[model samples]
Target: MRTIYDIEYLQEVTTEIQDWDYGLVQGMGVFSTSERYAHIELKVYTRDHYTDQIIWNVKEEYIPADLSDFRDEIEEVLTFFGNYLYALKGRREKKLVYEVIDGSFCPDTCMRSFVRATARALVNCFNKERFKPSPADLNRIRNSQANGLELLKSFLTHASQEEVVASLKNVSLTVDFKALFTENELFLINENLYNSIEILKKKEISQEAYFKKHKLITKYGDISQIGMAHLVLILNRKDLLPQVGVFQDEEIAYKFLSC
Candidate 1:
């Protein structure tokens, strides 16, 4: 018996695949545009016990110009292709898979055939289950999360000051900041966010200057640059979450949001 699976737009297209395991096939896709037509860029990859390799990097350049307007359809087509690869993970014959992918998904004409082909393939295998990352990947993620937590703790210990306390009155934090961060960290974050908000409100500083003025970035490295923005959105600027990129680290973001 065959079944159909609904595709999901899990996240913004990224070079890295999250939660990847050995022996699994995964792919990513993006919709791009030229003046004359829309293009769909798709890349598939696989990891054996030793190495990771790209199976194919394909671009379908003949999509109708108006196809870009149907963002959902683009996502659906790409996601169906993703689900097709998910079903084909262990069955992939490198030579045959490349040929199949090229002939079906990566053709020059358009995406209509690719969409229909992937949908039929998806129904044939009927699997859309996510695979867990390998043990090595799991360990790597754990270390990253630990390092990020320590970084946050260190930032709080060193950068927090008394001056930012006054600005706390104007900010209404959506999350229990106390639960996730110490008083000092919250104060520093509130101060930076307050200043950033003021800077944007007054339009007195360039966007570059606002980033430079962030307490987290000033004290820590550039990666921490996104930290203050995350804090701003996570705390008092919940309304702007839709418009901004909030999290830097995925595991840490999950933990922070869960809190």
Candidate 2:
């Protein structure tokens, strides 16, 4: 029954509120007000069981200020997370199949476990008959695998990790291990990948030779797979992968190789 008109009062109350160890759940809702800096402050409280923190200070003027608008905004955020969860589940359910086809589905142990868990949750949420991989799905998966391989080959020949990551910022991929892998794990993988690239750069070892030397390639079973894996690693390190328009189209992959 609470409405947006109460927001100004809530902001004043929040200034005196201290962090609670157990957290608030139902008492708070979405609230918004203007700040002295000419930015709007919006706070949205979520009903998640693990935490009850308000998403604060969203400085956009477009933010919802009315009850109906606030409901729509909340629904949009929920819908995004719902879709993300669904995709994560779909990816996890076919992890092994992806590994076989793509070579680098998830080379890291931690990431693999995370994918499995997420997939398992998805399975539990729906009927068993509802989730089945089709031939068309496999074909699309193969196409993505091939595209990733092409990008990897081009990257190895011409681009640095920084360059490749920056170029492909907006180019969305179906599988991403960035959320699963820890900083330490990423650093180790990147170090090994860099060393392999450095060896290749020296012209002492061929691509085949480099793959044989790298553990991830040997374990995962494809150089192209490793290349795709490296792309994900670069993405997780966001600062390393700034937005660039070079990877805006599929044709650019060939250009990368030609350069």
Candidate 3:
């Protein structure tokens, strides 16, 4: 199934430049993008005393299947901004203003190139794996440490017991649980798991309550928000209701639900 993600656009004035006078030159901006598993952000250019730069940001675990469509839209928007910057340069300065000069002060071609280059770079970044764990590795990690224990705790609450146990079995051979987790911690974790299973079987506790009770294991440290988002997407592959809590952006949650 195709996954849907959210995009956010942000614009701000920044003062990162220190050399050129903002009043005279009024050129030079950065363009950058940040990518996450469920959210993408396109940051607008900032102006200051020295330079101006455009920012494009994307946040996703994997590149969207509709990247070509997205790229076309992004390219158009960037081209518009690049043209705007070129115009600003021409209006503010006086040296051969209307002429398209190579290596000149903020030429139209330069803006176009910048926009296209930035778009391509952002696309490349999105395609690369940033923090996503492989299914086997994720299963092993979740069963081998305090951090993983807490995730398992939460997962058990959200997913079926059979599903959780099946995942654990899939990775048992690959992970050296004895080496990764101390016996005492493992004992406690096992007890918690068994107790959780019993409670779930009895249906005596609410899912939320059980999750909250076991979620305190290990302080839930170092869990990847992006990874969690990715997992949420995988779990909901059958069109199940999503149970994601890692994304700070509501748009991400909305997209997940709508998708």
Count of residue pairs whose backbone atoms collide, per candidate: 0, 0, 21
Q: What would the TM-score be for candidate 2 when compared with the true structure?
A: 0.19
Of models 1 and 2, which has the larger TM-score? 1
lDDT of 3 by residue, 127-223 (tens): 3232223464334322333243333334333323333323333333213222333455445434433322332233332233323333311123221
TM-score of each: 0.20, 0.19, 0.21
- Residue-wise lDDT of candidate 2 within 132-227, one digit each (tens)? 334643453344344544433332233343444443343333133233345665566455544333333333323444444432233223333334
Q: In candidate 2, which residue ranges exceed 4 Å CA deviation?
A: 1-121, 124-126, 146-148, 153-259
Per-residue lDDT of candidate 1, residues 1-259 (tens digit): 1222223223321222233342334332222122111222233334333422323332222222223423334445544445544454544333212112321111122344334333333232222332223364344334434454343333332222222222222233213222445556556646554444333333322333443454333322232323343565555654432222333344544444344
Q: Candidate 2 vs candidate 3: which has greater TM-score?
A: 3
Worst 10 residues of 1 by lDDT: 98-107
Task: Pick the winner on lDDT between candidates 1 and 3.
Answer: 1
- State in Å the error of residue 212, model 1: 27
Error of model 1, residue 240, in angstroms: 8.6
